[model samples]
Target: MVFLKVAPMKGVMRFGKKGKLSLRFVGPFEILEKIGDLAYQVALPPALSGVHNVFHVSMLRKYILNISHILNYESLDLREDLTYEESPIKILEKPDKELKKKKITLVKVLGRSHAVKVAIWEHEDEMRAK
Candidate 1:
């Protein structure tokens, strides 16, 4: 099985709703056909109909079968537009740094899961304003 890695900026700009910016991947879609050595044609859902299904090999990743990686399907409230919201549940760290003459703070945010790998570092000002 294979899945696609959602480009951070693209995901946020295209599929993110206001106050939500945490969906890192979109699908485990089936591969319809192979396109040469570096591309593939995939079966995308209706919500993603506007986008082309043919993706570069670099954009796809092998899906590892793991019970823990399986999300509760019923809990996901996916919209017809393929957009969803996910807010950080906790702030794990605040690191201050002096860049040039200005002070900047980096915030480590924890998502719904406690897994440390899922924590995302964001600018303190941006995180606070949101």
Candidate 2:
């Protein structure tokens, strides 16, 4: 199995989110056959059917299995729109970030389940409005 390196073309597909948080690679796709000296055809999902299946070796990363992957398996409840929402159960911290120009007040919101935990920093004023 190998992960496909995503082509960073602007205004194209973002596997998950936009901006710097976008997905860099997708899948541990199976290699169907060797296409040439440096390329191989991969079995990509139906969602990626529009894309060419064949890829160069340099664009693929080998997947190495280990204990951590199995032990930490947690499913994200992604919606049909590919967005996942976890309501903030509590505010963990009130951190102040200082920039060269000014100071920004932030509140750290904690979202957690029995297995999965997520934290996000939000503007203190915006969070209060919400």
Task: Name the candidate that leads on lDDT.
Answer: 2
Model 1 worst lDDT window (10 residues) = 10-19
- Mind sharing the TM-score for model 1? 0.44
| TM of each candidate vs. truth | 0.44, 0.52
Alpha-carbon deviation at 83 in model 1, angstroms: 27
TM-score of decoy 2: 0.52
How many clashes show up in model 1? 0
lDDT for predicted candidate 1 compared with the true structure:
0.77
Candidate 2 ranges with C-alpha deviation above 4 Å = 10-13, 71-130
Output the number of the TM-score-best candidate.
Answer: 2
lDDT of 1 at 58: 88
* lDDT for each residue of candidate 2 in 1-130, tens digit (9 for 90 to 100): 8999986766665876776677888888999999879999999999999999998999999988766776564687888998776667899999799999999999999876545678888899988887
